[model samples]
Each structure stands twice: as C-alpha cells, then as structure tokens.
Target: MGFTAMGLAQNSISGVIKNENNEVLSNVEVLVSDAAIQTKSNENGLFELKNLPIGKITLIFKKENFEIKSEEIAIGKQEQKIMVVVLEEEAHHIDEILVSSIFNKTQNENVVKIDHINLKNIQNEGAINLSDAIATNPGVNVVSTGVSIGKPVIRGLSGNRVLTYTQGIRLENQQFGEEHGLGLNANGQESVEIIKGPASLLYGSDAMGGVLFFNPEKYAANNQTEFSVNQVVNSNTQGSNSSVTLKTSEDKFKFLVQNNYTTHADYQTPNGETVVNTRFIEKDFKVGTSYATSRYVADFRYNYNDLNLGLPEEDIEDARFRTPLYPSQKIENHLLSFNQKVFFKNSKLEATAGYVFNNRKELEAADEVALFMKLKTFNYNVRYYLPDFGKFETIIGFQGMNQENRNFGEERLIPNAKISDIGFFGTSQYKMEKSLLQFGVRYDFRIVNIHEFGEIGTEGSFQKLDKNFESINASVGFKTEITEKITSRINIATGFRAPNLSELSSNGVHEGSNRYEIGNPNLKNEQNFQVDLNVDYNAEHFDFFANGFYNSINNYIFIAPNGNTIDDNFVYDYLQNNAALFGGETGIHLHLHEIDWLHMTSSYEMVIGKLDNKMNLPLIPANQWKNNFRANFNVSKNIKNSFVFLQANYTFNQNNVSEFETKTGNYLLLSSGIGTDIELKKSNFNVYLTATNLLNKEYIAHLSRLKADGIYNMGRNIVLGVNFKL
Candidate 1:
C-alpha cells in the first residue's frame, strides 16, 4: 500500500489505473519517462513510484488493448500526491469497442480525419447544447431554427446525409425532419468523436456526409462510490440547468445513474427584441449497468428524454415564459441497448442490440393536436475479430435495422412507411515500423414501403409505394511518418445514402420549415466520392496541422423553389443533380516554453459547395477564422488549475448564394472566461464565469434559419456554473 523509498527527503506519486469503462485495470505498466522508476499495478489497480525528483515530471501509462496515456505533474519538496488516471480503450485493438474508424488506431495513426472534443472544455465554454459544444471544432457548423433547436452540419452536408450514434447504436429519432435537433443531452456524456468525411465503410447508409459518435460516461472504479451535483444559469434566456449523477462499483458489477432538467424562457435578440415561442423545457434520465469476467462481458443501458419545444417563426410582443404557446412540439424518446462480448485467447466476438421509440406531436391550438407521429426502430450489429497473424489484423461485421413510422393526428405530412436495411463489411489493417495501412469495403441494401390511406387518387390520399436500393462502398487509407517531426495521412473513400421517406413520399405543406413540399418517388440513392489529406508537425514548443478534402456527389437531392406558393407559403419540390464540395482547415498551437504558463492558438476554415451548373448550394457556412490567447497561473493550496482566456472569431461575408437565397454580411465576436477548481475539506468544487459576445454585436449568421425573418442572433450574455463533488 506504500512506495519503497530509495533515498531520504524524496517525493512520491501513487495512483490507480482504470479503463474507459471505469473498470479497474491490473497489470498496467506505469513509468517515468527517461527515468529508471517503473512499476506495474497490482490486482487492485494501484501503483506507487517513490524517491522521485521534486519538480515537474511526466507519467506514462501503458496496457494491452488500450491507448497509451501520459500526464504531467508538479511535485513539491517532500510532497506525497495521490492521482487518478484513466486510459481510453483502443478502438482498433480492444475486444469490444465503439469508434468511428474501422481499424483500432490512435489519432496520429488513423488515416481518416477525426476530431475529439473534451466535454470539460465544452462546459467551460458555456455551451447550451451538444451542437453548440461541437461547433468549436474546425470544419463543423450548426444549423438552427432557434436557440433550442440546432443540428450539426459537417462540411456542407446535413439532415439525412449525416449519421449520429450513441451507446453503440444508430440514433433513429425522426432525423429526416429539417428542424429536428440531435435529441441528446450534454450531461452524462464523457466525450465526442467526429468523423468529418464519408464513413460508410464502418457505418452503413446515411453516413454519406459524416458521423457524430457520442461516448457515454464510464462507471466508477472498483470498490469506489462517487456523486456530483451541477447547476448552470444563463442570462440571455433566463435559463437554468441542474443535473445529478451517482456511480458505484463492486467486485464485478458497476452501475451509474443520472438525471437532468432544463428550462429556458424566450431568447432575446441583440436588438432587445424577444422572439416569442422560443422557450423550451427538457428532462433527461439515464441508467447503465455492466458485469465483466475473464471470458465474457455484458452491458445494458437505458435513456429517457421528454422535451417541450416551441416553434417561433415571427416575433411576438409577450415572450418571457418557460411554457410553449400555440404551434409547439412535444417529443418523447426512449432508448434501450444491450451488448455482449465473448473473449477468446486472441480473438473476440461482440454483439449489440438496440431499440428506440420516438413520439412527436405538434399542437397548433390549445387542446388540439395537428400533427402526431410515432417512430419505432430496432437495430442490431455483430462483429468478429480474427487472431492476428504477423502484423495483420482483420475484422468482419454485419449490421441491420428495421423501422416503422405511423401517424395518429388530424394531419399528416408524410405517409405511414416501413423501412428495412442490412449491410456487411470487412476491414483489415497492417502495421509497420513507421507506417500503417488500412482498407475496408461494405455492401448495403435498403427497402422502403408506404401504406395506402384514404382514397388512391385524392389530394389527401396516397397510393402504395415500394422502393429498393443497393450500394457498394469502399475505402483505403495510409498513415506514414515522413520524418521525426512530421506525419502525413491520405484517405480515399466512397459513401451512399438512400432517399428518405420525406423525400420520396411527402405531398403537403410542412409547417416546421414553412414550405409547401412535394416528393419525387423515383429518386435514387445519393453517392459520393471523397479524398482527404492531413499533415502534422510536432516540436518542443509548437504544433501545426493541415487538413484538406475534395468530395464529388452524384444524384444529390435538394428542395428547389418553383416560383409558386400555396396558402402564402413558398412551394418547393425535391430534385436531383450532380454536386461537389472542397474545403480545408489549418491550425497552429504555440507553447510559450520560456514562460511555461502562456499559450497562443489560431485556426482557419473555408469550404465551397456548388452544383455542376456553377450554382452555389444553399445554407453553406461562411469562411471563418478564430484566435485565442490563454494564460495559466499558479495558485494557493485552496485553489487549483486557475486560468483565463480571450478569444476572437471573425466570419467573412458570404456572397455565394443560390438562386433563391440572399447574401449575408460579415461580423466579428469576442468572448472570454475565467475559472478555477477549489478544494474545501473533503469535497471539491469547480466554478466558472463566462461572457459571450462581449461587444454586444448585432449580427445574423448565414446558416441561421431565422436570417430570412430578419432576426439577429443572441447578444451579449453572462453564464455562471458550479459543480460540487461529494
């Protein structure tokens, strides 16, 4: 239970190692870089290193089937510190893993471009939703109807083209709707990994654009119990959010539970105008349990979410409540999943099954429901890993899903439909001394069937429709270290997406987007081919990275206006054409080694999307540049990790417009924040104060759906948050 001393008046470090699942990991190797002090964790996942220099030092943790983790610490004279270290499971090397990539490899080794967002950093930014949190990443954007409704857009693609996965299952919460958010809460989530390009080789259809993978929080360590309470308050909308989480683990069983509630009033514009029907309320609950043994492991999770969201298309005089008025939506979602893994000597078999139910109702008047839809989805996946032979490792997998959509309200925008999908894929990786190569291929088949209702040839009736689609997708990539300080990766991949129900069957006015829409039953699957290149350089004081991509799509589907209107709403119809997109992102990080507590970072991103006729795509984000300066300071014993940061974001004028879209002007915004961790008795607290839009600028984002309505985005706002751990 103690470190063996090698000298007098020496410092010591003791810690425990746990895997991403929060399970205690034994036999983990802990080492001091460039030092002779090294030890392995015991059966209880505890290790100690004694007689260490009383200065700055770095510790490295390594284990089989897990990514190597490194942490830096500062030790005082004759100081004894206890630490807790967490190791992420290697996506490509672990027996059972959930990742966006096909092969288990670190970010530096993966050929495909990927980005990771730490939730702690997002929380510090005072993000209101998951989309807002992820928007900080380069090459990612968000499309929003209002503050309460936002969806992630990768490059220039969104909606059905992008896929979202949680708990190792594809989320099926009626994503085909234009105004639907991701339907996920930010609490109880550990981190997010974004694949910024086509990823159909691992995930099947609907990944023609990219993928957003959310990893759930891990359980507590063995024989450990922990609880936390968090609260956040926002000024712009007079909003408040509170959450509580409890986790405990025994010898072989681990459990976790979390509950969160959020309520917000109508958001105020920079011009001091209140946009009515912008208020919302949400409740989320999550529970998970896992049991593990040497040869078998089982895990189960369940999540429930209820939301009351308002749809604001026009400005109203009185808007300051938390309840939705007329023209609002009540949505309820439930997700349940179970996963099993069988571990062999050198290979593993993993199976996962999930079910999701989504109920959505749109109320146009008090006690009257105008639109209601129920969606049910069942999905399953199985993957088998073959024993590694030499330097080659292979995995084969199969995935399938069945979905049904039904309506029970007075009006229906889309017909009742049933959809089925099945796909098979195989991927392999070869590792060399300084290079890694990966390749994968997949085949997918989908079927859609629409039921007939009312009369066959009436405006309010629909005829029976059946459609089938089949596609073959493939990908190949390579990662190589060009020199001791530079690395490069190149990837070429193909993706496809089947036409969604709204695109193939819609025949009426949609109130959500305020458009009269028609569908094309003969639409084909959209296909895309993309090539990506990434280069990076890492030195002692500086790090730099550049990413570029070119994508070409065939049979691209879009809704185009036909110069007509129905009941004062613009009329649009689904159409197909050839399109292309090209973009790149570059960034640099400079570490002030001499000062050791100062840093500077900057990045720029640009993208362009157009059809074959040279017409620009609608709703594309404008080019942007971001810069940040941060300073870290040493504090007293009661305070830890104190820091302050200043940031500036500039968006260029978006002159590129489609035939029916208007141009948007440019704007700049400034933000700053300060935070610190406090220790009191046996408990700890994290407190932060953040200010956004410090200049109180009035501007409209080019991608905002409210831009056409002449409504500005949120203005200056202050946020205060605190977390107490017990």
Candidate 2:
C-alpha cells in the first residue's frame, strides 16, 4: 500500500550515481527493497524516488558494467533527503569497465600496491595541500622547499619519474625543477589514488616511478542544484584559504564549477623566528560538464591556475604578507580536455584529448624579467575493449604526446626544443574463483629536436641536436587467495624513462637551487626492472598488510659536483650510473567490535637507494613510524559524527647519506584534532579544529631542500575549518 492511503507524509530520496573515477553513470536502475517503487537514472546519472513512507529502507543501485550497490537509508519527517552514491566497476564480469590502468581491479585483487585516500575523512588532518594529504599513506613522502612548495615521492623516486594525471589528462607544468610544486589545488577534488610501482606499460615515459590520479567531484542529483562554501585559517603562516562550488544536473547534461584562493605569509619556526620569503599566493578556477546516453558519453573540462611564489633569502626582513620581492616567480597554467566513450553491443571504445599551456616568468629585479618560458603540450589516448574470448578479457590502446618549449627572457637555461612520443600496448586478464592473472606489453618511441643557441659563460653554444629513443616494456602479475582471510600478490615489471630537456641542455646556474648545472647530451635512456610483493590479512576486528619492492636501474642519471666553480657557485653536472633501490612498508589496524567507536592503527616504512659503487643516493627519506588512536561519539541531538584523534610520528636518524648530503637527527611529532557535524534549522554544517606539531618540536627532514641552510620545518600550527552547504 502507498503512504498516501494511510494518510502518512510522503518523503523523497534523490542522489547521483558515479563510478570509482567519480564519473557519472547513466541508465542505472534504482529500486526500493520490499516496495513497488522503482526508477531509472537519467543521462546525468541522477535518480529520484518520491512518495516514500517515513521509515528505514534499503535502496538498490544496479547498472551494466558496474557492481550492484545496496544501501540502507533512514527517512525522517523531512520532505526530501539528498545523497551521493558511488559504484565500483565489476572486474569479474564479461563487460567490465576500466576506470584507469592502475585501478583496473579491486584493491585486494590488484597485483600492484595501490592506496586510496578519501578527502572527506582527512579534511581535518591539518593538510594544506594535495601533497600533504597524500603523505598520510604508507611508503609515500613529500620533498619540500617549504610549506608552499612540495612534490610527491613514492617509495624513493620522484621528479620526472613520477607521473600525475587529472581530468583524465597528464599534467605537464615544468615539473623538472626542484622548487616547483604540483600546480594543483586540493579543493574540488573527491579523492586521490596512488600506484606505488612502475606503470610505464600504461602511461609511457614518466610512469617509471609511479602514478598519482586525482578524481574530480561528482554532479548533483536530478532536478536539484546545490552550492557549498569552505574556509580554512592557519596560525603558523597566517594563511587563509577559501573556496566555493556550484553544481547542477538536468535530464541529459550536468555541470560543475569551482573557484579557490589562498594567501599566506612567512611560516614561523619553533624558535619564534619566521622563515623569510617562504610565502606564496594562489588562485584557481575549474569548470566541467558531461553528457551521457545509452550509446555514447561525452565529457569536457577546463582548469586555470595562477601562482606567485617567493624565493627564500637569508637575513631578509620579516613581514606577514605575500608580496613577492626580487628573485621571485609567477606561473600561470591553462588546461583543456575532452573525453568520449562509445558502447556497442559487445565492445566499447574510449578516446581522450588534452592541451596544456604553461607560462613561467622569473624576476630578479623590480622591473626586469630574468627568465621567461612557455611550454605547450598536446596529449591523446585511445583504447578499445574487445569481446570476451573464452575466459580472458583483453584491451588494446594507443597513446602519444607532442610538446614544445620556448624561451622569451634574457636568461636561457634550456634551449628551445620539440618532443614527440608514440606508444602502443595491449593487456589481458584472466579471472578464476581463487586466482587472477594479468599481463601487458608496450612499445614506445620518442624524438627530441633542439634549436641552436649562442653560447654563454664556460658552456659552448648548442648546435642543432636531434635524438631518438625507443623502449619495449612488459609486466606480469598474479593475485591469489590463500585462505578465507589471507591474500597475496606478486608482480614483475620493466619500465623506462627518457632524459628530460633540462638534463639534456642546461648550461648555467639554476638560481632557485643555488647550483651551477651542466647537461650531458650523450646521456641514454634509463631502464629499470622491479619485483613487487604484497600480503594482506583481514579478520573481524583486525587488518594487516605488508608490501615490498626491489628495483634495479641501468643508466640512472644524477647530478654531481665536478670540483669546479662558476661565478662562486659549485658546478654540478648530470651523470649516469647503475643504481638499485629496495623498500618495504607494513601496517596494522585494530578495531574492537564490542567498542565500534574506538580504533588504533600503526605503520612503518623504510627505503634505501644505492649506486653500483655502494654509495647512497641523496634526498632519500628517513625511516619512519606512525601511530594513531581515534574515538567516535555523538555529543547530543544537535551534533553527530563527532570524533577525536591523536597521532604520533617518529623519524629514525638517517645515517646513510651520499657524499654531498648530511645526516639528520631523529625526532618525534604529536598531532591531534576534533571535528563534528552540526544540525541546524533546514541546514547542516561541519566544523573542525586541528593542531599539528602540538609540542612545538624542532626538526629537520632528510628530503627537505631547506635543510642545507640549517632551517627547521614549520613550528606548531593550529587550523580551523568550516563547511556550509546551501
């Protein structure tokens, strides 16, 4: 019987349906268990079921190529209830859909080690940037100049070896520099996924080290429009961040837009002293739209970012503002992309194309531009899923990129160059009841052309230079269930990386790093072979995991001092050698079913990088241990989802160092936070307060570029954040 017959108030439930990548899925069937209510999602992946009784009920969501999701929801006396539902692709089905090359299977079924971080869970963890959020995962670290600049380091590798993808496009914004950040904002992102092993078979050159994938936020439910505002304030840097987002969806179209701005002053140290010129200002805007049907899907996205970064100087005047002085940099980036998917009766095809333009200018004086460069890149990819043959699922893909770099300033670092790449790959997976086997192979070719330029200083002018590189890579992996509670994965992969433009043509001092760098035109491609193993065990109240990897690289490139001086600066030249790196991470989570609100977790990670001569590599992160205790509770009728957490982090002394690096002492850090969701009249809000480095500890990190200047990391920081929805 309907609620109207009983004279009871009718409530409505509405929500959006999405995949693991946060992309909307259309044609989904939404049904209420033990009821006659049923509905189908529209092209925007939005669904609604109205005229429901005020009670607890189960909602089932099912679609082709995706796993069926069932959620139990409580309907109050309110007129409407809004929700966001996420569905994962089915890996064991004949019509499985691929979210990404790294996340093709479930976490337990994948051969490689992958970690996922939900932004909502860590929003109150005192993270200021995307890198900060990612660092919470085991075996993941950050190389930083200061709080304003950070780069992700997976295992023990970074720089050109690590690849980042957003909006289904590879990001290229002069990532070869040590002082450059990721050029992305943490706002408007749903989650982040990290692949800790070689992924060159899927992403080509830069995937030799690892891959970082950012998932965008989903659209609003059908016939609904919503907006949100978020604000954050930090005491350490006197920083303020604000962002706003608006999303809406109709029957066949969905749109989302967001804008964010951040400003900060010099960060203070534990000793009550501020680090001068360590401030930055950033502005970002993003817009996206999607259209989906039963036969085809189309998506478009654009992002614009502007940054003003300060260069650290010794003995500079301290101020609580972000006005960059001399020797600063201004960078602007624009990215546009379009993606399409076609579904047939028994097969599917996907295509994506993207373009990025980066403009960077460095000022050494009030009115003079020392360095100005522009980088333009175009990327394209296509993949086709073939019909299932017997018990195997296969995919064939092609990917390529065309890039150009131009200089327009007085100082020239690397010559103008054009780069082109092409690659072809195929992969297959066989799924069984107790075991899964996966393998893939790829071949890539690259060409680089450099234009001649006049010589400067002791470096000779570059003649017309042309180079070509080719590589064949492959990977084989297996996942098996040993018992009802244990699982294991074993993988062997080969990856390669071509030398970047700076490593091939630099001829002068890099002012940002305060070192004279020389390039090696004769350098060859770096090749690596690695083996990874992962073991996992799960019980009713306990979870444990261990991951290990060993990598060997031929022709590994590094910069070394040549025992010479250029204008009072030490001269460093790029060199190549055979190198090896081995590392492992382990963690355990304990929860008591009797006390479901209490949880305890601990983890440890260690890595070592060495050359063929037994010399350690520079900038390797120190071994670290982390432990956390959290409690969840409800305060009263007006407050819910309340939680308190305490965290302890300890870093072991780094005694293993390169000849050019120094050892760092061990230290410990303490952090804590509390947050809750508040219910108001016709609205809801979230508030959080976090304290980092609660003890005001002073410490130096091994991977911190500022360590050379005897500078300590940021001191105690108190952060407050609030979110409002309308």
Candidate 3:
C-alpha cells in the first residue's frame, strides 16, 4: 500500500517545457529527484520535469556540445506554469578563444574563419556602425571617403577583392561605384562578421577583400517580441530611432514581423558648422515553418527596403542647384527567398534560392534632372553532407543578374547590361577524436554583355565595350587543435571580380562622393591572392582570438588617374588602375562570473595597407584603439528583476595619417550608459540612459568626408531609450 502511494506521488508533479521560440519539444529525457531535476531538450527543444516538492528546486539542461544551462526556481503552487528556456550557442574551437563574429566566442563547423565585433561592448564605447566597431581589430581599416560611407579594407583590399552578404546571400550594390555605402541598414543589426582574406570557395567574386556578413534581430534566438524607442538630442544633431518586433510560435509554425525607422536632421560639427542633413526609413518582416513528418525543416523569408539619399556633407551648400550635379540618390529593394533542409541517418541536405529587385533614382533640385537605374538578381545554392569517409560536404550554385540605366537628357542616355555567372564548390571535414581538419575549393565562370549608347562628343564616344571574361578561382584551408584550449587555422585562396555595369558605363558625378567618377569601358577583370592565419584560446570564463591576413592583387582596378578632364571646375580624372594591397586584424575578450552580479569585456583592432610599391594606401585607416568597461548589479528579488549595468568606452584616434591624402590628427571620444531590466507578471520592461561624447571632444575623424571643410565630429549627445517584451 505504501509503494502504491509513492507511485501516485511520482505521477502528480509534471509540467510542460518549451524552447525559446515557444515550440514544444519532444523525446526529451527528464529525471527528477528530491532536490534537483535534469533533462535533455527534445527534438522540438521541449521538455518536462515531474513529481517535485513544492519548495526551492534546481534545474539543469544539457545537450551534446551545447553550454550547460542551470537555474533555480521556487515551486510554491500545486500546478506550475510552463517554463520557456533559451540555450545559447557555445564556442567549440577553444574554451579561452575570443572570436570576433560571436559576441561570446561560440564556434560553428561551417565557419572556417571569423571576424566579429560585439555590439554590447561597442555600444557603450561611443562606437557607431559595423565598420567603426571593427576599427579596433588589428588588420582592419575603414577605407572611407567620409563618415557617411565606410568600406572594410582587409589586408589592403576591398571592393572587388571582397564580398559582402546580407543574411546569407550576395548583396548587389553599386559597391564598385565608390559612392555607395554598405547599402544595408546597420543601426538595427545584431552583429557583423568579416572573413578576412579569401572566402571565394564559399562566396564568389567581390569577395577579394573578404566578406561582410550581417543578421538582423530575427536571427537572435531569444528575440521574441521586442519594442524599443531611442532619441538622441545633442548640440550638433537631433535624431530618433525606434524598432518593434512581434514573434510567436505554435508547434511547428513561427513568424516575425518587425519595423524600424530612423531620422536625423542636419548634423553640425563641434565647430558649430552644419555638416550634412540626412534621413531614411526601413521595415522588414519574415515567417518560417518546421514540419516533423519526414524529418525535414524548411524556412522562407521576404524583406523590403526603401531608402532616400540626401545631399552629401560636401554638397549641402548647393543642395538645391546641385541636385543633378550632386549625388542625391534613392534606392528601393525587394527580396524573396527560401531554404529547406532534409535530415538523413547520419547527414543532411540543404537547398536555397532567392530573387532580388533593386531600383535606383538620381535627381537634381536645380533644373529638374533625373536618372533611373534598375538591377534584378537571382541565386541558387545547394549543399549535401555525408558521413563515414571523413564526412564530406559539397556545394554548387549559380547567379544571374540583369541591369538597366537610363538618363533623362536633351536626346537620350541608356546603358543596359547583363551578367551570367556559375560556380561549383566542395569541402571535406575529417574528424578524429579531438582532432579536426577541413579543406575546400571553388571554381567560377562569368560573362558580361554591354549595349551601345547614343553617339557622343569628342570627349568620349558613347560606344560600348562588349567582351566575355573567364577565370579559375580556388581555395583550401585547414584547422587543428594545438591543445585543449588552443586552436590554429590557415587558408590560402584565389579570387576575382568582373566589372559591373556601373564600373563599365557610369560617366557622371557620384552623388555620395560629391566628385566626378568616370567609368572605363576597357577595364579588365581584377584578381587576388589571399592568405589567412588565426589562433583561438578559451578558458573557464574567458576567451581570446586573433587573425592575420595577407592579400596581393593583380589588375587591381582602382580609380586610376585619367589624365583627362571633365565638366569645368573639377580636375583629376579617375578611371580604373591596377594596384596591390596587404594587412591583418586581431582581438581579445575576458568574462567573469565570480563576482556573481558584475561582468566586463575589453577589445581592440588595427589595420594598415599599401599600393603597388608597398607605399601607404591612400585612404587606409590610421592605427586606432578602443577600450570598454562595464558592471551589472541586482536590484530586486521579488520579480526577478535587476539593475542591469553601467558601461563606459574610450577610443583613441588614428595618428598615422595617410601620406597619399591629408590625415586628421589623433583624438579621444568617450561614452557611458546605464540600463535596467524589470520583470512583470507576463512581460519584461527595459530602460536605459546613454550619454555619447561625454567629454564633448571637438575632433574630426580621419574618415569623415567633411574633414576637408574643417567640420568636426558631432558634439556631446544624450540618448534615452526603452524596450518592452511580451
């Protein structure tokens, strides 16, 4: 009779468990004891613990290589509510390793290399944008015309030598146009990854400088329903930024709807001078589904962006009349894509396809001038994984793009182009106990077509240059563990970049650069030789990682000295010229839990490059450094809330001015912020106070476009924001 009573008690205490996405997990192993309960997350990441005392209890969650998660909860009621848990990805390469891509140095097998900047650390340090955050990394530099636009220059290469992907697909921007910024919205991004050197084995052309990758809020595991609003009011500029997202899940269905808007009036320098008046808007939405019928998972996404460009800081003086002369441009983009995965006995297969449409318009306020351009792109990629013989992986993909540019003039200006490209890529990973080795290679083929424009003046015939360019690209890499806490990786690769429509036909002033940019019809394709070496270290609670890179270019098509002239006032003709480049980047991090309620992280980056003769690269960033300090403390116990933290950052400006161009003197910028998390019955409230440029430093950034005008960076700024989760 007593044994029967014990059995009834064991069946009395059980509750449901769900993953962070709210999906019910199945097949999870749950073990309950007198004081603690242990369980394994199910296929859907759900679990349940039954038959427990109504008092304080401890829970532990674990999986193969995932970080062990533990928490204490009070069981005061008979029927406990369902609990939702989040499992963060952990760095597997090294315990003490501090990789740049993952905020806390989590590792992934698909990634052979990574370059990352933690937003939390940089947010407190007065850093803005993905480029500025990465500036502290060793071999990285921002080849910027001004603050409005910044491009990553790794090992002295960018543009065609590098590749940039938004989400996971190629981003088609007039990046080769010189005036174009990264094109994607940066303010709301979670983190950015830069794969220095060659990534051609995975990403195709324009990846010579490496790859700039980003994931929006939806990419974060714990990003469910969040709402945030921020305002920055200062002596130099007035701005506001806000974003809201709604996410929900039921069994195997999930969706995320998000919207973000930012607007900043004209910003002035500390010198009390107006630099530039700019503003923009962006909105994104996505939905995903997972079906367990046939051991398959599928996801589909669609996003849209509408951006309006205003006059550049250098062109604001003539904003009205220079509308046509200046680079005031507008761009609208729409994208649709889908990815599916099929899990087999010991392997998996993945397939992905996407389509993108982009439209560009340029207008001048002076005489009713307008220009229109459109680009359409399509892409497809597939990968298959197999076990047994060292676990092999292979990938194949193809991309096709068509573009058209039309200019409104007295007669007619039309430039149309088409591009077709295909590539085959393969990689193999060998695993032996604690040892791992990986190698990959890719081949690319591309062709271009150009149609003639109306006959033009003696300055230059509007004739088109039609030709087919072909090249072979390849890459191989290997990674190994020197010790339990140390890992090393090395890679050597080849890359290529074919001239895009803008590079081959554009013959006007680039609105963003506020300068005349001429295109070369006879420009040949550019090629690159790239190499990388990296080391990762991990400890119980701390991590550190470093990356080194070297890149050499042949037929490096840069803005060459045309020796000719255009219009009347501007001189110095710019066409495509061959150049060489090289450089590297490194970073570190330290985390502590001994203090219980306090934590801190610190990091830095440096980059340098040169042209053909190893001379100083014209726009290469000067040596730079950044440091951050932060602390968190608990404030309440009833609602499980905490007085989050206070953080401060100091940045050392570059002293190594470019010899090719005048360099700005070194300067210092500081910032501080405080945040709090409040727990509610069913939601969470977060609030923060941030002060930027605390010292009110009156200094100009070397990368600022207004440097020539003696315009300083923005003066002290204060921002107040709030976030709500439900």
Per-candidate local distance difference test: 0.83, 0.83, 0.54
Could you tell me every candidate's TM-score relative to the true structure?
0.88, 0.88, 0.78
lDDT of 3 by residue, 461-570 (tens): 35566667666777666777788878788877788877766566655554455445556778777777877777878765667777766777677655533444566424
lDDT of 1 by residue, 265-339 (tens): 888888898878888899999999977643556789999999899888654445447888778899999999898
1-726 per-residue lDDT for model 2 (tens digits):
012122224467777888888888876878654233456787898877765444445577877446667665555544576678888764321211124543255465566657777676776899877887788889989999888889999889998989999888899999988878899888877778787878898899989989998766666655467788999999999899999999886655778899999998888999988888888899999999877543556788899999898889775665547786567789999989898876555566779999999998988877899889999999998988786788787889999999999999988777899999999999988889988899999999999999988854455355567999999999999989999889899999999999998899888888878888899889999999999999988776788999999999999999999999988999999999999999999998887778757889899999999999999987788999989999877789779779899999999999999988999999999999999889786567889999999999999888888999999999999999999987
- Worst 10-residue lDDT window for candidate 1 reads 90-99
Off by over 4 Å in 3: 1-111, 116-156, 186-190, 219-236, 279-293, 313-327, 391-414, 456-461, 569-580, 591-604, 638-660
lDDT assessment of candidate 3: 0.54
